[model samples]
Target: MSLSAATLRSLKHHNYRLWAGADLVSVTGTWMQVLGVNWLILSKTGSAASVGLSLVLQALPTLLLGLWGGALADRLPSRPVVLATQVAHAVLAAVLASVAMSDPASMTPVYGLVLASGVVSAIGGPALGRFGAEVVPREDLPNALALGSVINSGGRILGMSLAGMLLPFTGAGGLFLLNAVSFFAVIASILAMRASEMHRLVHAGENSGSVRAGLAYVLRTPRLLVLLALALVLGSLGRNYQVTMAAMSAGPLDAGAGGYGLLSTVFAIGTVAGGVIAAGRPRLTIGLLLGAALLTSVAQSVSGLMPGMAAFAALILPIAAGAVIIDTTVGTRVQLDSPGDMRGRVIAVQGVVSAAAGAVGGPLLGWLCDELGPRLTLEAAGAATVAATLVAAAALARLSNVRLDRAVLLPVRGILRRAPAEQAAALP
Candidate 1:
């Protein structure tokens, strides 16, 4: 397929197009709010620690209650669940805007609103995840997911750029108000979608133990276990780029804030490129995910040894690209492998693991940076990531009859075509 054709394939679906448009708006607004919040906290407290604490407050609820939310998603109608959450988000954004306008110096209400928004996100995430699949045909599901990532990366770049321009006049209050309006765009688009056209999956039946069922399912599935293990390690050790990059820019590179900003811009660009590349693929597989993870870790390790800022910056593009490929591939695999009824629960489980890794890894990596120096910290993290990938690959090879050699050599589509019926099913 031509590049445009490949990238635009998912947009052929009407529902997906609507969802994509709305999501782009929503994600852009979200990034603006993120930047506004960081700026506000820094200005008010003049403490980096305070800014970090605000982020932790936002992520904590998602880490703790995500699974229960997923279970709820499985039991309820996805549309209603999503609508409710979007409304909740809008209300919170409006409240935050009011507080910012009325009492800009008060940190307590701002923190409370951020925490509330996080709670709504934790509950809505799984439903929104499953809803995306419902909007597109099965063959287009991967493309839709890839496109979603593209929207996220593109929006972050756009929103951050716009925030820089808008913040001087509007203040954080204006940005919050803009985000509040963005939520309505999504709500309107969703309302416009044809319910009958959606490829609705069968809902998981109501059960008191539904959340536990998701946990049990993961424990029983070897492929899922391996996938999660790799995710845990990569997320915890390899993916704490904020900490590593900040330390590297300030300490070893002596590049300061400008260098950090440049690095972030480059990484975001690379991520957008990766998402477009992933959208072109016809299928995703375990081999692709593992290969991407291994490549990313290796590249990060090598980049840490670069002698100058320019050389390190050059290497960061591939590192960022590889990370995005790994994330998209793993997410696609999880959605594909899961049964319709259990998809929400499975996604929630993945979210929980990722959140937990971030919660733990951020502090650990920061400590490592202080103790071992930034360059050594990156090298150590890369080594840990490589070790985790190897262990996961070994277990997969033994449990699922996956040949590492073949997995490494074959294109995902070719590998699927060549495998025996039962072996293909068994191959992770």
Candidate 2:
């Protein structure tokens, strides 16, 4: 298939274009703020562990309220839910900026504001995800998801790169204020969308399923259970490159902030390329997901052993690329596999998997980087991801006789592999 055609199929819609364009701008700023938050703690405490703790605090809200947020998204329209959350985010960011400006030396304001923003994000994240699905038809949904990854990764590239450059000039407070301003673009896009064109999902009633129902939904679906397992393991262990990368840049590479930004940009580039390839897939398969995971896990494991900064950056490209495949496959599969009424809840479940990863993995990994060194930390993460992939593949093979062992051994089998129509039904 022509990659351009497949990628553009969804972009042809005017509403998506408007929403996506504005989203690009807003997402870029959000990343800037993310780097800002992490950098601020590093500058103040000079501890990677503190940076990890901030990540935990950000994810903690999702553990507490993310499911409820997804339930609310299912019950209400995504636009208003998203709009309300965006406004909340803007207010919190502005407050952080103000506090940062007044008390540049204080740690209290940073933690407080981060926790507050996390609370809003818990609600907004699912609603925002569901909004992307609503803008395109069922056929275009996969493409939109892949393209969204591209946009998100692109934002990381621009945001982090710019943050590295601007941190010296504007500081963390400036990033917060800019993120606050960026929300207006998304708000305007929401207001501008033609509601008549949206393919909104039909609900059973004003109220659909609860958080418990969402958990039950995933528990019952074997595919989702397997995919969520992958997400938790890979997302938690394999993907906290930020901490290791920062440490590597500062310690081994001796490249400092500028070097860290360069590494991030390259990683984002890999995701963009991977998203494009994933966008071209007409249908996704467990074979593809497992294959992608294994491939990336291997890259990650090898990355830890690289001798120098140059080789390290090159190896990370493939690792980051494979991450996009795993991410897109899991996200697209979970969304399409579930019924419309269950969409929001399912998305929320994915969030739970992510939160669990950060809540547990972030601090653990950060501390390891301090004690064990960045190299060993990356190697350990890679080994865990590899173990998770093989375990998930084996589970499917035992239950469905799907023969994924061959898929894991032969990298090329993944591209050629197609799943059984019913995914060998009766998986628990």
lDDT of 2 at 385: 89
Residue 265 error for model 2, in Å?
3.0
Give candidate 1 misplaced runs (Cα > 4 Å): 409-428
TM-score leader: 1
- What lDDT score goes with residue 341 in model 2? 84
The lDDT values for all models are 0.85, 0.82
Query: Which predicted model would earn the best lDDT?
Result: 1
Tens digits of lDDT, candidate 2, 64-85: 8888888887878888889998
Candidate 1 local lDDT, 200-285, one digit each (tens)? 98888766339999889889998888898889899898877878888989989999999998888888988998888778766656
lDDT of 2 at 171: 88
Q: What are the clashing pairs of model 1?
A: none
Model 1 local distance difference test score: 0.85
